[model samples]
Target: MVKLLAILIALCLGQAIVAERIVNCYWGTWANYRSGNGKFDVSNIDPWLCTHLSYSFFGIKDNGEIQSLDTWLDYDLGFINQAVGLKQQNSNLKVLAVVGGWNEGSTKYSSMAGDWNKRQNFINSALNLLRNNGFDGLDLDWEYPNQRGGNWDDRANFVTLLREIKEAFAPYGYELGIAVGAGQALASTSYEISNIAQHVSFINVMTYDFAMASDGKTGFNAPQWAVEDAINYWLSQGAPANKLVLGVGMYGRSFQLTDASQNWPGAPCRGVGAAGAYSGDGGYLGYNEICLNNWYTVFDNDNAAPYAYSGDQWVSFDNVLSVQWKMDFALNKNLAGAMVWSLETDDYRGHCGEAYPLLKAINMKLRWT
Candidate 1:
């Protein structure tokens, strides 16, 4: 009995010695415009729940200058100030200004990265914005470097851009990160993963959106298989396991089934699902709406994901259970941590029994005491 007790104690001590993993959450500027109960502002955030908060997004201008997509909220309305001010409550929290989301497109990024002068100009612009706004770092959300309207050379030029940015950020002790695609083909072709990893502080792998309305088939929004494949591919390409952060979707992708009987995965879909109550977007529903609405929840043991069906509409999203599974997977793989797409989509109001339940699950699984 004493020997067994000693072994258990040793294991407990070993766990306690492990460093805490990062919980990076992305906050959308447009979430302030959400109507009704779903609306979210910087004040809605719980600083203690996250180690880092990435503000999305800042745009790249034609002249390779960095600009805020929403100047009024990012500057005029004092959102940036208020966001950074959260550090007072949680001293360990870090805020990063994210640049180039999907809507910003890749045309300007390609142009900026291709030319030496343009790349320097962009780096300088980004540094100025971060320093002026009191941000601790910068996150490059270039969408896809070599795909999505970008040139083939982007695969190589991306590494150069990150190297320059890292060099510039070194003296100031600023952090640099990038968001990468989650598919094997997209990740391998769009990123020189090993080279880029050497420069950036971390890589946020976008593991959601595996299935969409246009795919013509019903499936999980972010299947477990895609997550495993993406992470393994990055690791194989020499990305440090400690610098890869898994991306979790805070919303669900909805699909309109062609026939009610065809509600299972791989079934035919006619079109996108109906518009959400607060998100105001067709074919997508935030966790807030998903929790309130009544649907028969079905867990896909094979995919390690969950989907819900009500009438002819089917929505696939990550719940507390699935999020926990992902967190566990990250721990088992010795990964750096996990990040959420947008904090606004979460059930932040406690309407779903607890405030930020999904995020809470992450915190618990990551052993953040």
Candidate 2:
């Protein structure tokens, strides 16, 4: 009996070795595609930033067709073509499309899953889009699975859809990936990560955005300790380290308020504005969006998590230095790679060079290996 148990342990360890062979870093890009003003440039993608680059396919109408800010654009295949061309030039770069996001949420996931025909149609379209565009894989960003905000009802069924898509994409040699929420609260209540991890090449844990767009508590988007805790939970729940990629926020949240609420004081200011009530942004003034542009500012140290304050309004946003810390942590933990929320948010042209700094630092640290 003891010998049999040893054999079982060995086999399990071997399987784990295989599962964690690849690490991925994900970045989201909804504002870029739909920003309309062209303030952000996708063409400026730094191939050396990470091994893989990903963008979100946002503003997708209910029916599965791609929609732009002003027009029902046909399947031009221009962006994909351009992105693919860039990848072909750089052997180290791999691009993937991230479908669904926080704003769009998972509202239509169940509906798409329930109707087999629709699901297949969507899959076919996505696959074709990928193939024609020369994308290496597809990353599903379905915010939540069994949760309610997006009116999702078929959590198990959604997994079934993933199974089907993986089977379908296999023949074409297209890899499948997924982005999920982090933290114990989300882990216990929302995603079935352990059962689902085996199906994808990597699972991206969105380690940031903890405070929320509506809060007064200033904090980093993705704290390292929080990330550690979250990673430990997922691993405990059966997620392989190699198949797990840590997420870091390239941008910071900014808020605005009077001196009446000087909760967290002496925080750095790249510039201040009323955006992302729980985070920080520069020159972006006034509280016009969803949340309060509250009373806090945040920053993270060797940990990816951030802490901050603005008069009484406090916020925490991770700069490139903080992101580097998390990347090192991921490497130290023997995890796969990192995934950034979106590419456009980083200071590709100017604003701040946090994103580039983090990516460059990650490469520098990994150079020895």
TM-score for all models, in order of appearance:
0.95, 0.75
lDDT by residue (tens digit), candidate 2, 184-284:
88866666666677678888888876654345333345566787888888888888988888876655554443453444433333334454421224422
**lDDT of each model, Cα atoms only?**
0.90, 0.60
| Tens-digit lDDT string for candidate 1 (88-160) | 9999899999999999888999999999999989999988998898999999999888777898999899999
lDDT at 367 for candidate 1?
Answer: 54
lDDT, candidate 2, at 266: 39
Error of 1 at 46 (Å): 0.2
Query: Which is the leading candidate under lDDT?
Result: 1
In candidate 1, where is summed lDDT lowest over 10 consecutive residues? Answer: 13-22
Task: Compare the candidates by TM-score and give the number of the best one.
Answer: 1
